[model samples]
Structures are given as C-alpha cells and as structure tokens.
Target: MSWFEYRNQVLCAESVSLAHIAKEVGTPLYCYSTAALKANYEEFVDAFRDRDVLIAYSVKANANQAVIATLSACGAGADVVSGGELQRALAVGVPGSRIVFSGVGKTSEEMSAGVAAQVHQFNLESKTQLESLSEIASKQKVEARVAFRVNPDVDAMTHEKIATGRRTDKFGVPIGEARSLYELARSLPGIEVVGVDLHIGSQLTDLEPFKKAFSRLAELVNALREDGHDIRHIDLGGGLGVRYRDEQPPTVSSYAELVDETLGSLGCQLILEPGRALVADAGILLSRVIETKQSSERVFVIIDAAMNDFLRPALYDAWHPIDPVSEPQPDANRDIVDVVGQVCESGDV
Candidate 1:
C-alpha cells in the first residue's frame, strides 16, 4: 500500500493529528510510521524480487535506532558511510556481512574498525583510498572486498550539491578509468575488486538517467568479465526519489523492471542502497505554532523545529508542505510561509 493510504492523509509520515504528537512527544518531535517504512521497504524489495538483490538501508538519511530496528526486522541490511553509522547498524541487529560501507575519506582507524567488523564491501572512491584500505587490510591480515565507485559521467538532472555521478563531481572513479583502477585493485594484494558501484544523485524524478548510468556500467562490467575478473555484484547505488510534492517518480517495480530489462541476464547479484525514499516520508517532523507574529512585509508562524530538526529545507532550500491540525481552516488564510525553526541563524528552514 502507498504511504498516503497507510497514513490516511496526503502526508505519509503519519503525524498523529499534529496536536497529539506535538503534545505527547513534544513539538519538533520526529514521528515515523512503522507501517510506511515497512511498506516502502517491501516495495523496493519486491521490485527486484525476480533477481538476486540485497537492499541496504542507507543510515545517513535517518539513523534513528527504532527505525533501523524496524528495517532490520523486515530483513533490510544497512549501507553506512561513517564509523558511527556502522556501529548504529550493528547495534540494531544488522549483521556485519549485511553492511556495506561507502565514503570518500575513510580514516585508517575507521577502516580498521570496518575491517574488524567484516562488512560485505567497501565502496572505495579513489586510488589513494584503495591503497590506504589495502595497507590497512594487509596489516589486519584480511582480504577486503572492494568496489570501485564509478562516475558514469551522466547527469542525474538533480540538484548540484546532491549529484554524485557527474564527470566533474568528486564522487567516483571516471567511467573511462574503471579498467585501470580495476587493474590497480587486482595488483593490490590486500584488496579484491568484487563489484561496481554508481550513485548519480539524490531526488531523481526520472528513470532515463538511471538507465543511462546502468547502460554505461554494463559495458564496463562486460569488459571486466572478458578480462577474467570475477565481478560478483553490481551495486546500483540508490537515488530513488520520493514525493515531497505531488509529482511521482518511478516506482520500485518500474525500476526493477528497468534493471531486469537492462542487466537481468548478467547473473550478478543486485544491490540497492536506498536512503531517502524509504524513510523520508515514513518519518515526519512534528512542530507546533509556538508563536505567530506579523511584520510589515509578511506574517510568520514560528515553530520550535528548526533546520537542525530536518536539515533538507535549509540545506537545499527544499520544500515541505505544512498544515495545522486545529480547525477554522480557510483556503484564503494559507500562503507560502517562511516557516522557520528556533535556530539563531538568520537562514533557518
């Protein structure tokens, strides 16, 4: 079921009458629906049901333990970036093998900790990083399963800050250089190139970009295969968009269909790293009208929640629809509110 249906409102995060959650849990409280989370998770899983897939919930989006525990209960592994996220995933019963670590700068200490944890793979970004991981793995006496995060050089057509796979982005290895990077990994004694990873961007609304990214990656995969590399998985790093507004992005089923049509015959395991779509709508930031004031230019509905509570708006100048639970509703009274939080910063979301 859609999160809208589950929440019984246009919003999916399930704010319990606004007043109730604000009064009980306190204003600025974050509320998530277990049902919405599970349903969204299941939808993604079901999309790739016909293929060998492992959906790893990205921990950076919302690292709440209660939410992670719920996803863990539904057989969701974790895709973590930092050491703290790895610890959080482990704390919530997600096993080591189920976790995949990805980041640009991984410290030796952090690498040592993840190596000790024995995660499934580290989505290595740069050659220097790969070497560092190699040295660390050698010291620890372990074979590190590493995947080259490839920059497909495709435009995800999303915001600049969130875009990762573009040619100019400091995200992954350039698509043309994957073979050389793979050779480098092969030559490294402590590291094994087990898979390929690509993350174009976040808040992507169309499938064409993904298809293009995957198509480019497929050629590289086949090239590696012909070169006698035992590539086991294709980690199509997730950027599945969610409805923060009325528009619809591709459904999980459609994405799965695209994957099936594109690379179903490759026999490599499919791994998805979805963070926002699965949890963003499943969770809602609850705040109250702490005070209302009118200035000469405009009116303000000041609330306790701030950019700190949910940083998306402040970070991206993103839009989130707000409503009042109390009655005396009027269409004329509503307008674009510079709804702000308690942060002392002048630019608060």
Candidate 2:
C-alpha cells in the first residue's frame, strides 16, 4: 500500500492521518513509514537475489534507531562511517561481521571500536588509516579484513559537494595505486587483503559513471588475482539515488545487471551501501503555517518549523513537494507565498 496518500480531504501516512499525528505527536515532527522503508529495502535486496550480495543500509542518511531496526529486521546490514553508527547498528541487531566501516578520517578510538566489534571490512581510505588500523588490530590480536577503496577517476555527475570518486576529492586511493596497496597490506601483520571497493558518489542518476568505475575495478581485480591476492569480495560502494522530487535514477535491478555483466565473472561477493535511495522517500517532515503576511513585492507564510528541522532545503537548496495536511478547498484563496522557517538566517527557507 502507498504509505502516503489522501483520504477524506486529509493527508495520511500508512493507515494513520497526518492531521491526527499533528494533533497527537505535534507538528515539526518527522514521520517515517515502516512499510515504505521495508518495501524499498526488500526491493533492492530482491534485485540482487541471484548474486552473493550484502545490502548495507548507509546510516548517515537517517540514523534513527527505529529506521535502522526496521532495516535490520529485513536482514539489512549497515555501512557506517563512525563508531557511534557501529554501535547503533549493533544496538539494532546488525552484527559486527555485517558492518563495513568507510570514511577518510577515522580516529584511533573509532578504529579500536571497529577492531573490537570485528566489522566485516574496513574500506581503507588512506595509507595513514591503513597503518593505524593495522597497529590497532595487531594489538587486539585480530586480523582486520580490508577492501582498499579505490578512486576510479570517473565523474559521478552529481552535486560537486557529494561527488567522491574524482581525483581531487579526499576519498579512496587512486585506481593505479591499488596493486601497491594490496602488496603493502599483505606485508602488514594485522590486515587481510580481501576485496576491492569503489563508490563514485551519491545521488547519481547516470549509469555511465557506475559502468566506468566497475569496468576499471574489473580490470584491477584480475590484476590483483594475478598478483596472488585472494580478492573475494567487490565492494561496489553504493550511490544509487532516490526520488526526492522528480529524479530518474537507475533502478537497483538495472544496477545489478551492470555489475553482473561487468565484474560478476570474478567470482566475488558484491556489497552495496545505499543511504538516501532507501530512506529519503520513506520519511516526511510535518510543519504548520504560523502566519501569512504580504509586503509590497512579496508575500510570506511563516511556518512553525525551523531550518534545523529540515536542513536539506537550506543545505543543498533541495526541493520537496509540500502539500496541505488537509486538502485545500477548490475555491480556497491562492497566493504565491515564500514558505520560510523561523530561523534568523536569510537562507532559512
């Protein structure tokens, strides 16, 4: 069933009405539909039902325990960047072996937590990070499974701030340097070289970047095998986008086909870390108008919400279709009003 719809001249979430939620839970509330989240998650997993894949929900998109726990219930793992996220995953019953830790700057304490939890693999971002993780894991007397995240030097063609695979971005190692890193990891006492990882960027609508990055990764995988490293898993870091407004992102099934066609011959497990694609549409921010004012050149509708309640609009100038909780009458007055938050910032709209 559609999680959000209109019934009896009112907006509803699942079986409950948004107006009812406003009266009880109050406005300026964030609501998520369990059915919607589970359906999207299951759809992604079903797309890879034929492959050895682990769909790890990216927690950075929405870290609510209920959200994580819902995905966890659907057998979803977690792709976390911080120790707190690891803890959150664990708390929600996402085991350590199912978690993949990825980030550019990982504190020693954070590394220790991961080493303690024994996460699935650490997506090695830099040599310095690898060195620190190796030392920490050796002290803990455990072999840390690692996948060297490589920059394929492909443009994701998404927002510049979100694009990660470019050469100038502070992300994974250059594609040309993966072999040397694999050799170096073999020499380390605490690291086990297991797989190759590459994520172009987030909110990517084009499949070309994924194809290019995966093709490069396929070539590198064969090279690594020739170098005698047991490349078991190919962590195709996830950036499959979601429909925030009117985006036409590639389907998860199509992405799976691309992976199978490009690198499936390597006989390696595939891992995807989807964040926004899974959760963004599953949730909604509820607010109410406080007042309506008109100036000489403009009209404004002040809402009870603040920019902090929903930062995407201010952060990325994002667009989300807004509608009245109660359907506006056909004969209702109409005006072009700039709906804004209560913040003092000029951009808090």
Candidate 3:
C-alpha cells in the first residue's frame, strides 16, 4: 500500500521518479502523493461508515492546499486551531459548518473570526474562553455551538511533550470540573452546549488510554443528560499514531469499534480530529547528500536540508528512515555514518 516504492532501481512518489523530481524542482523539497492522501482519508470513511461520524482532518499536521483539497474532495472536514488555519481550510472550500476550532490559547480576535465564520463547534479548554466566546457570540447575536474539552487525566504513554491528558498539562479543564462548567455554559448567553471533547496526546499507539478516556466521557455524557443538557456531539480529538519506525498503530476499523463500544448508545454525532495519521506517510522530504566526512570518532553524512526544514529529529529525537535515490546492490557495502543536516547547531542530527 506504500505509494513510495522503488521502480526500476529508482525511488518514486507514486509513478513519478524522485530523481526526476529532484532534477527538475531541485533538492530539499517536499513531495506528496495525491493517491496516498485520498487512500488515507478513505480509510477513515470506510471505518466509520455505519455511524454518524465526522472525520475532521487536523489542519496543523500538513496544511498544504493540495493535501487539504484532496481530503476535502474525499468528503473530509477540517479541524483547525488558529484563525490562519481556519482561513486555510475555508480557502480550500471547506465549509464553516465542517470546521471545528480547537486550541488552548485562542485570542479574542481569533474567537471573533471563528464566530464570524460560524464554525461548527469551538472546543473550549477553559471557563474564561467559554465566557469570552459567550460575550462575543452574544454581541454578534448568534449561538456559538460549543464543546468543553475535559481533561481525563489519563497518561497516553507516549512522549511527555505530546502527552496532553495528564492533569498537569495545560490543555483541557479537569474532568471532575466539566459538569459544573457545562452548567455555567448553559446559564451564559449565546453559548449552546452541543458536545464534549477530549484529546489525550499525540502518537498514541495503544487503545487502553483511549478506552479509559472514552469510558469517563461516556459517564459524563450520561450525567450531563441527567442534568438536562442537550449534548449532540462527542469530539474525540486526534492522537492516533502513525508508524515512523516499527510502530503498530491500531487500525481505523479497530478505533471505530472502540468508539462504538464506548459511546454508541449515546446516539450523538461522533467527531474525530486526526492530523498526523492522515498525512504522515503520504509525503516525503527529498534532500540531496551534499558531502560525507570522517571525524576522529565517527563518520557523518551531510545533507542540504537543515533542522529548520525538517524538525522532528531535532525537536523530538525522532527517527526517519533514510534511503538512497538509486537502488543499491544487495551486496553493496554499507557505511555506518551519522546522517545530519547542515544546520550550525549541534542538535541538527
């Protein structure tokens, strides 16, 4: 199913050769497979076909217009965090009703823009944000459909920087305090409590964390219904991990089954925001090897690409597979060298 494969001893993005692309567009460029993008988006659609689900592609992962438009053509909505992201989604003809504005620090201006666009839901992280949106929407004379992103406090068992559901993280309000906030939201003007939202962390490979969070959310939904709130949506923010190396992420079908098992009885529209899972494997960073040098201790392979160009390795110590554009012979001698960027920083590896 990989679109990037070797054909006739040349690595290709779909049917186009990478060498041809590099020769034409030059190195240090990004190439995305339109077919791969469509296939990834369709996987979600096929998984949740039987349910009332919205697979909102998280725009922050890969905001390329071509990627967004490809997904949009596949009937994918957008999950945007900032005003610029909202505009980007809108620019691709993604309707306001299909956009979910989600972020921890949404400014007043950003909230106003989201309100003006009439985004489907605003995943409010704090009570002050709830109040701000209420005031803005009240002045604008429109009911802003809102969801409270409650912190489930479950460890996603991923990278610490990406793990967000822990109580100490600054993302969502505590779960115990969500009901009281929902009550406050109902009392406030121009705020319509439509759903509940929670995003535990990114690059999550296991389902236990999700099961724990969704179970708690289900309990809250039952409690919220008892308290006389018309909750119609459940925004389970994205954190599904994709395989960068040896990661066996749960299948989309399995994820959908988990959702059904946890919240199917609630009869609410399910919203999933998946960013990296959709585009991570759909694109590749094509760079040329500038030089190879030997040091007293080790050898290094330098490339024209820098840490600023591709930051995962520099930022998260992330690993990505490196391959030569030309297919090497099976018996070709391999040199163990540290592949690094040309950035002036030591962390450029």
Question: Scored by CA lDDT, what does every candidate get?
Answer: 0.85, 0.90, 0.94
Residue ranges of candidate 2 with Cα displaced over 4 Å:
none
Give one clash count per candidate, in the order shown. Answer: 0, 0, 0
lDDT of 1 by residue, 109-222 (tens): 888889999999999989888899999999989999999999999999888899988898989899898899898999987898899998999989999999999999899999
* lDDT tens per residue, model 3, 1-349: 8999999999999999999999999989999999999888889989999889888999999899889989998889999989899999999899989999999999999999999999999999998999999999999999999999999999999998899999999999999999999999999999999999999999999999999999999999999999999999999999999998899999988999999999999999999999998999999999999999999999999999989989989889999999899999999998889988987899999
Instruction: Write one digit per residue (lDDT tens) for candidate 2, span 224-283.
Output: 999999999899988988777678989888988998899989899989999988898798
For all predicted structures, in order, the TM-scores are: 0.93, 0.98, 0.99
Q: Candidate 3: TM-score? A: 0.99
Whole-model lDDT, model 3: 0.94
Q: By lDDT, rank the candidates, best first.
A: 3, 2, 1
Question: Which stretches of candidate 3 lie above 4 Å from their native place?
Answer: none
